[model samples]
Target: MKLGEPTLDQLHIFIAVAEHGSFGGAAKAMGRAVSAVSYGIAQLEAQLALSLFDREGSRRPVLTPEGEGLLAEARAVVDGVDALLAKARSLHAGQEPSLTLVIDVMVPGEVAARVLGNFRRMFPTCALTLRIEGLGAVAACLIEGGADLAIGGPVIGDHPALERQAVGELDLVPVAAPSHPLARPDVAPGESRRHLQLVLTDRSPLTEGREFSVLSPLTWRLGDLGAKHSLLKEGLGWGNMPLGMVAGDLASGALVELDLPEKPGAHYGLSALWRRDTRLGPAASWLVDAFRDGLGD
Candidate 1:
């Protein structure tokens, strides 16, 4: 607050220098020219008609009495601005910082890597965290204030709090190594279905209480996609795998697609659940779009 004029930018710079104790440090942190930072601080002090800092350069800038009051206010203002910018940048760059997105069990590490890699590339300064867990875990995170966004399986998610979106459809088709006996054309698809199979999800296809329950049999039960893919590649067993997860192995002839009599599948589902009563934070809104764009392909 000032008699002549006031600027949010000037106050921001002043607070940065005051907190950092150096004009150069503030400039470096804010990605602004050193001279510009110093000038902005000078303008801020002039408008307030008070010497905010005792900048005699003895050691560090000591705050004067009037500056102390302003410092408290400035901190709150700057923190608000930071949150605002994080939201704005998420919208602009199509990525969010400090986001908690729910991930499905079948969502491979590779897919997460690609999306988060692109996000970090676009917003280097952002703080992005990834939580990898089951679909139930994902839904719990979204509903209980643990995470801002989530990618949960429809099978595990039944919460009335969520607003789900159909980003893209994925097939959990069975795959095996090229050299596996059933992979040969002479072997019938029905015969292949009986061979040893690798199960990925913790819960079987029957857990959803679907009308149908005749799923193909797999001998080995594994948790992660990487392990399942590895087992499949080794000709240990056929696995109903995420198409995206086995892309590399398929292309490289390390794994061959198995023809299943009945295609046992799961829909690539995403449920964005927030407290409907509470307004969606700017960060949350931006994150929803970012994930949609990434997975919508």
Candidate 2:
């Protein structure tokens, strides 16, 4: 059966009222005047040759069985309409690619800053915006076209069209201030076993199952390296450091490295992604490349 339909705004208003059980509730949700919302629903009913809301003999309107059926169809129609609108908005938001890049909080501290800094320097015309979110959220923003590009951890799942490239590896080293007793250049063998670790725990520290010092006088837990560093520099506790972030600090003696028995590093990679099916406009395409060139990705 060929079905003709009411417009999306009308359909949306219908669904809002259908779900909310009151025109006034729907109006509040839609942020539309009650009269406008009512008119939209009325138009939707007229276009469909169906009475969507039950008229209680000029009393408060209610849904009949037929109205119940219409509500089901209305929900599906509204959802599709919402998706179509979102796709259009994503294109508009991502088309030019002249917007901000949000970096995940877990991203390499140096890489995030460098990527944005170089992106702006290379394309001064394109405004560079920065934000912080979780790794999963960063990927979602890129896919949703809300964010142009992000430099963060490896995105799980298959994204054939999305460009996932590695920019650098993160060498996680136990680090501390020169004033700390653990600031040693060489561990003859098991010397590091006695060192106390200031750990970051969104979960147990990655070093938990490994052969290393556990701060048995267990103290000083931080969720962010920035916070840990602030405390570390204040002589609060010793913790692991991203080599990239502390390179300058280490060189200038602002921080010192504690020797590890072996290489303990997380292979941190930066990935650039976009929809395979969609063509980024000149501006967005250029921004993608600017990100690559920044990291030499």
Candidate 3:
């Protein structure tokens, strides 16, 4: 006789019986009759040509070695089917099946975490891919069709192919480690040009040959914001950082805020950006509002 493939329902029953430990328990959990549950398991075992449960001596049915071996695979099949059904439901409701979000590294981690936590609860079926980028890279991702949505800073301002909405602002303050020369009160604003500035380099060509708030010609261009932060803490260079990111360091004297003659700091405007021709999906729409509300507070 040829072997048969296990139906989804049979796999579910197999898992349910294994979890509840007996046919009666499985029946109560599944809202099926005990005899039906028993027959379903028997049918599954016969289809697979394996004895799933040993029902001989003990009052309760225990999983045979074969049953134990196949339990994980059965659960995986059931999970995959459930996910497929969920994706179908989301599609029917006009939700995006998946979204790719690129964010500027300047966005505070805590704020991102809170917004994403809410997103997970609101759209459990929508798969999310997250990328953290700096400068023009955020806008580049959206323009290149690599990202569905993005939260970016002023560098994205010149992109005409993208639509944007102001979400919030970040205060970029020049800071240096306490041990650095720039941290001294006597250091004049003009003297800042003598020291190396740890500037964030744009990975994309969108902002080539352009500078934003660059105070020093002597500079160390870093692609990663975290690396700049670490280098600043090590007294390797003086550079601007989001006030929210360096508040504790400023307070603890690990880093000192620079009193630059140019100005104390500038507010970097953050905007939610997406392709001009693409309509915002439900999850993406909700995310823009969430970022606005979360950052406003």
Candidate 4:
């Protein structure tokens, strides 16, 4: 006998029956008649040449081993189709299929979390990917189309292909463990230069040969801020960190604020940048607005 094609509607009915454990229950849940739900399942099993339900001895039909295996496959297929339809509908409404957001490590944690939470609720159908990078790497991602948005640093110098908007400034304070030599009250500029300064280095060549607020001759260049925080706490080196990130450390005496005579504390600007040519989708635009608004605080 020639096999028939199983329809999506049949699969939906099969899933409902498997989940509800009986045709009558599935019919009640789906607002269909019991006979219709049973017939759909029977047709599906016949098309696939499988005995899905065993009706020999049970009060309610129970799944055969074959039926148990097919149930999971049916649910996955149904869910895949649903997701495909959702993505299509989202595209039809001008939503992006996915967004790539690259953030500078300096961006305030609270602001990033609030904006991302809002983005998820506002654009449930769109996918989001996040990358955390420091300095020039943030701009490189935007320039190379590796990211849809960037929330970070001294944006790769005036590029015509990029657009930047001010977010807020992070207060970069030089700090060290209280036991570190530089934290002493009478530490001189020449004396401080001998101790290691943990400086965040950029891999992107955009800032090659450039250093920011580096006052020490002996230095350790790191790519991650978290690593710098850890090294500072270990009395390994002294470095600048965002005040928001180290406030607790400062207050708890785990780390002490350094008073470097050559370089005082500085405010580094956080900005939102994107490709000038590619217009942002509604979700991305909304996020940019949220970040700009948060800069007020």
Candidate 5:
């Protein structure tokens, strides 16, 4: 804001001149008069108290060591200004500055990948933050106002305040490493309870007393699906995993599916959740639609 400080327009011209290497060429490329381009650079140099170009006895202006350093800074300033303008335009068009999403591990990876890829293309200016949680933790994030949208299982407390729609369900299969005792086809229920079971524990208190699809009395609670998958692969324990997560393992014989009469194969449906009182902006709404469409596909 100082009297001699270089303006964004001047910086843009300076960058163009630096890139093109001559006043005449920069002017021609930018569709401006050479004199105007030259004057802008002169003013910028004077304001910054630095000689940006070596014009002595040369047809094309050459950048000095100092000029090279300042050129990078000038280009950065111009880009920042352009981005500021774009953000203002996005605000005027009702696009949110940022969107936060909390997704469950049970959500199909392919569905999430497809939706997120489309989202990036559709809303390049909108900042996105993604978090992966387990079961009730997904809805807890929405309830706590920590996320703008949630894609996961149902929550227990204060459900009325949450608006949600079913997107898709994941089929979970009981699996164990090939070396685990349960990997055998004829393993009995009594024998299964004696060994350890890997289970995904809820981080939120919403499902504190409730357990779903848990057959074994002895268990190890884990929050991350990847960790459970690793332990299962290492023959540490047996547990249910989404079919997609373990499909390759199942096929490769790294893991074997267990038939548990006590706990049949189960489905965990993903729900797109948001607060009922908050109105979604363009980016958030688009994400919801994208998730629904991806699930349908």
Candidate 6:
């Protein structure tokens, strides 16, 4: 005799019976009659052409070897169907199924972590992807359709194709290793021009010919902020760094804040960026507000 496919109801009854160890227990758990639970299992076994339970002499039902082997597979099917239903429900509620975000490297890691943790709790069903980029690369990701939203610096703030909202600001302070001449308290402000300054270079062409807060003509351009931090600690060059990133260095005397005549240090503004033509989904909107609240201080 050819076997037939099991129905979802039959699968549920099989799982319930296996879990409860008795037809009466399964019935109570499912809010059904004991006879109905037993009949459903009987039909399932007949369709599968297998003896799923060994109820010969035991007072409670017990799964046979075949039933034990197929239990995990049944659970997987049920779990997949449940996940499908959840995604459908999220869609019905106007939530995005997935979101991609790019953030500027200048944002404090602690701030990002705190906001993202809350996001996960608030939008458990929304899938999230994250990227960390420097300067214009953050905005480039959003403008090129690689990200749903971006938290970037001032470089892309005025782009006509993108809309933005101010999120927060970071204080960029010029710093150098304690051993560097620029760190000397009596060093004249104009003397910094003679030394090499470490400056962050943009990865994308969005800011190709433009420079921000660059004070020295003699400079070493670096693509990564971390590299600049490490170089500053090594006395290789002096550069402006976010206060949040180098606060410990200044406190410990590993690095010292430089007082330049031009006052290159300034507040770096951060903003959330997205394409002007698109409206944000629920999860993305929540994220923008969360970032603003987390970093607003």
Q: What lDDT does the true structure give each of the candidates?
A: 0.68, 0.64, 0.92, 0.87, 0.85, 0.90
Question: What lDDT tens digits, residue by residue, belong to model 6 across residues 42-160?
Answer: 99899989999999998988899999998888888887887888889999999999999998999999999999998988887888999999999998998889999999999766998
Evaluated with TM-score, which candidate comes out highest? Answer: 3
lDDT of 2 by residue, 1-297 (tens): 444578878878887887788888999998989899989878877777778788677556688777788777777887776656755664665544356566656556555567566655655445556767543556666666777665555533355545665544455666778887667666556554455556654322322343332433455655565787777776666776667677888899978876656443455555655556555565556655665565554
lDDT of 2 at 183: 71
Candidate 4 vs candidate 6: which has greater TM-score? 6
Tens digit per residue, CA lDDT, model 3, 152-264: 99875767899989999989899999999887776675888889999999988888888877878999999988899999999999999999999999999989999877774
Model 5, 149-261: lDDT tens digits are: 98877545349879887877778899998888777776666677888999989888767889877777899999888899999999999999999889999999999998765
- TM agreement with the true structure for every prediction: 0.58, 0.48, 0.91, 0.85, 0.88, 0.88
Error of 6 at 59 (Å): 3.3
Ten-residue region with minimum lDDT total, candidate 3: 181-190
At residue 274, candidate 4 shows an lDDT of 95
Best by lDDT: 3
* Clash tally for model 5: 0
Q: Which stretches of candidate 4 lie over 4 Å from their true place?
A: 1-4, 56-59, 108-125, 155-158, 186-191, 289-297
Model 5 CA lDDT for position 161: 78
Candidate 6 local lDDT, residue 41: 92
Q: How close is candidate 3 to the true structure, as a TM-score?
A: 0.91
Q: Please provide, for model 1 over 72-159, each residue's C-alpha lDDT reduced to its tens digit, 9 standing for 90 to 100.
A: 8888887887878776866686544456666776665665667767766655555666676553556666667777666666654555
